[model samples]
Target: MTKFFLLLSAAAIAAPAHSQTSPDSDAPEVVVTATRAAQPLSEIGQAVTVIDRAEIERRQTTVLSDLLATTPGVTVTRNGTVGALTSVRIRGAEADQTLVVIDGVRVNDPSSTGGGFNFGNLLSSSVERIEVLRGPNSVPWGSQAIGGVVNIITAAPTEGVQARANAEYGYADSVFASAGVSGKSGPVSGSLTGGYLRTDGISSATSGTERDGYRQYGATGRVGVEFAPGIGLDLRGYFADSRVAIDGFPAPDYVFADTPEYSKTREAYGYAGLHANLADGRFNNRVAFTIADINRDNYDPSFGNDPSFIGRGRSERYEYQGDFRPLDQVRVVAGVEREDSRFNDGFTFADTGITSVYGQLIVKPLDVLTITGGVRNDDHDDFGSHTTFGANAALALRTGTTVRASYGEGFKAPTLYQLFSDYGNRDLDPETARNFDIGVEQAFLGNRARVGVTYFNRRTRNQIDFRDCSPSELTTPGSICANRPFGVYDNVARAEADGVEFTLALRPVDALTLTANYSYIDTENRSVGDDFGNDLARRPKQTASVNADYRFAFGLSVGGTVTVVGDSFDDVGNTTRLDGYALAGVRAELPICERFAVYGRVDNLTDTRYETIAGYGNYGRAAYGGVRLRLK
Candidate 1:
């Protein structure tokens, strides 16, 4: 499989060059997360993957994480079924290091142990677009961007009134449905979407017998009003409520098994902004306020009806951004932001705040060359002040070649839970990292085919990890473990990751499209411990996927995808191994008249048995069928 990927990559690079055009004309051409401003793909030096609504529907993906797994430089692991604990890692970075933004609002949970966003309950119901940046970018986004950033854009108003609805049913007693509407009238524009899903999921424990169930309800809304030519007010909001049955360690033998245990999560975020463009769109300014609130509870029927555990997290942010273009060749973007976060564990409460200011310069010294530089300073209430810098350059040649390079620094403050929880440490320092990458891409066959390769390296220090207390330390007075008996969080680990990514896209003919990408990531723990030099837990060294889709002249479409992953150890000590596996999926859509269509998909077509995490059961072969309706 590795050899096949390499050979395909070589063939693509060796292909003859032709007049340059976009390899995928239908893909989103503008990206907003790279510089906190909309920029053409050719001008951005970062490694990014853009997935639009058309691509999502083509694959018939119901879950957002399932779609993200197909992108390059990304890896996803779900503990068991659909609604279990899910984590996404980029370029071998920790799951919590990735920053998640929805409609321009940060949604990381401050009350969680790692303060990361759970992708398990995220559905593709109202998502219009998704942008994944595969390297550290702290200059514009602030903390928790050590790994990279995932920016999600939900449904928005269009030029005319439109309505869409979809419904599906499948194995495991599952049901899914969603509906959305968007329109513009005069100066006002608005959109709203609602989604629901429920399923009798597979057991979380490998040895369990009972079936676990899951359910979710979600909605997204956006409204905008233009008062003047370039002045507008924007409001956006999102909410999701979910409940999932989970397995737990039983009391008798203390072994993993099915139990009457469940978890519930409620998440909501909102954003409001006022913007104006002056000097004929040369100078733009925006003032925004954003808030995110999340609540989680765990219950055990044997222990009564009340929740056994409860957690609440909330964040409020105020920010101002300005963009100025004095000349066509130079542009400047600057922003100031203040964010406050609070967390409660039903028994204890804590709060923290951070203030930051940043500025970036984008200059086009030549028509084909673009360079960008930026710096940021953040003042945390507990961790003092820290600074970060980043730079990147992109060069495009008339010979159908483009070269890109970037260097970025990342700084992440400790989460509220890590600083105030029972096992927390107040003297912990912030985690930091340095990331670099370079790549070259070539267009061939009149840009109907393209090939690209990139190399990236990152080093992280002062990584926070839990350290168990020794017997002597527990007995010593005034020690770090004076009160805590089990363990404490401390900055004790260092790590490094280096990887290569290859991408190929081909449009051999007008009706068929094929795309493939392969990633090889090497990660190691460099901390001073017995586990030093060992590969990071659950991080496979190689992952690759190939997808093809064809649209017939008879209003019918068919697509299929195959994904392969390499083996890796499941523990930092390299004791247990989790063998890798391959998965295949097939989907077809046929239009019935002009406003309705029918779709069906078969996942795990070969019934391959695999597990991303140890001792967790994965899905088997399943089939689903759905229908879609559109009105304009």
Candidate 2:
């Protein structure tokens, strides 16, 4: 890690030293995840990545997690094929520490072991845009932002009537189809999209022979009505039902292998809100209600006809937000919210609630500078109250350069599963962290080339981890694990992560675009145990990706992508090693008419053998083709 940083410093010092001016004329991009309100990307100090619908179509990626893995400071690990257990880690933080929001509603599962959102079931077909904040910002987002935030925004109303559809088929007898429509007829505007996917996948275990399969049906919709010039009502909803074959250890062998086991999951999220613009749109206020419901079931045909396990989780939230701009240079955003969570495991039920109030102040002290500060207070039913604060600043110069710095604090309350599951420990405490980062960006060559680099550091305490029950404790009277022979959850871990991210984009010509990024993260386990000072499990220290796309004069486009990942330990003890690997793919599209087009892509061109999770199978060389139709 030290050598890597030294090389990075050397490269920075060797770069050309020259004065440049801002020449770009394109409109500035707008993002909402950083501040929970629409703000120009250049005015925010936090690191953020935006992937739009055009980019999604260009990549030809059906699974959202696959695309997210290529971004800087992000890592994804899957147990098996599509629809299997998948986890996303940001900057070496645990999966559950990252908050996921879909269409303004939190979608994390309260019944899961870690209460994290599963990215495996998320398809990119209905998504219109995604905003990823790369560091802790709990002050505005509330709890579970210890790592970062992933905000997914779906399709919205369009100006005129429009419709689009796509269908694709590929390896493993896979099939995918989707359609969407959006328009505004009178005072009402609405959009709806639906999709389906099915694939005969490979075995979950590396050495297994039997093939597993997966199927999913999903949909999203939004409707809005403008009653008057300053008042409106909006509604949104999302739904998905999926099933995937899984492998388990049979009694005879008690080893990881293929088995007649599978799991089914259903997720539904909904939101309704009323908004009013007062004082000539300077004071905007909104009141909203949201809910997330999830159900999961696992079955083992070899054992019985009924499901062997069942789990359910739900979240209901009431929120009110108001943002006022009393002066042209000053803006204040404030919000109050209450959330209730419930979980059931077919045997016992548990619930919890939290109330939070937060506010932020945005000040443009000068024409070239902007500063933001925020604070939040949350009171949990079991954990009492906690407060957090965050602040950031951005400085832009006419020389086409920008400098940013930020300090943030975050926390994550214990989930119902951790506090009430079979191995639960009611004494578990919430996780907390402190984060800091600074970065600079520069654009040159008539705004055709751009480069940026950032450095971040974070420290976390009271991290909850699974602890094995000792023989003596299991048999002792009145012990914490007196009757629990397996294990228990406890807040007995600490961690620290520091990393550097570098990004580059070049549009050397009118028809070609090239982009690349690299990240180096150094993570350590600070707990007092044998794994002390060791690297975190399943987190790569280095990751890099490069992509290039070109369009011809006759409506033909071609592109390719390459991703490289470095190796790291699979466990905290560092007893198992996972090797590094590379992936490469190519794609092309050609228009057949004004409203129709054909496209194809070949993934895993080299068929590299690799694994993100130990003992899990990974896909190989595969090919796919599709057709698209659009009408306006």
- Taking the tens digit of each residue's C-alpha lDDT, what string does model 1 give over 1-632? 75445433432332211111227575537899989998988888989888888888888888899888878889999978788888999999999999999999999998888899999989999999999998999999999999999999999999899999999999899999999999999999999999999999899888887888999999999999999999999999999999999999979888888898999999999999999999998999999999999999999999899999998999999999999999999999999999999999987799999999999999999989999999999999988899999999999887879999999998779998889888888888999999999999998888788899999999999999999998888879978787678899999999999999999888877777778889999999999989999999989999987777777799888777777888988899999999888777777899998999999988877788888889899889999999999999
lDDT, candidate 2, equals 0.89
Q: List the residue pairs that clash in candidate 2.
A: none
Question: Looking at model 2, how many pairs of residues clash?
Answer: 0
What value does the lDDT take at residue 391 in candidate 1? 95
What's model 2's lDDT at 599? 98
Where model 1 places Cα greater than 4 Å from the true spot, the runs are 2-22, 26-28, 475-478
Which candidate number has the best lDDT? Answer: 1
Error of 1 at 447 (Å): 0.9
Error of 2 at 592 (Å): 1.2
Ten contiguous residues minimizing lDDT sum, candidate 1: 13-22
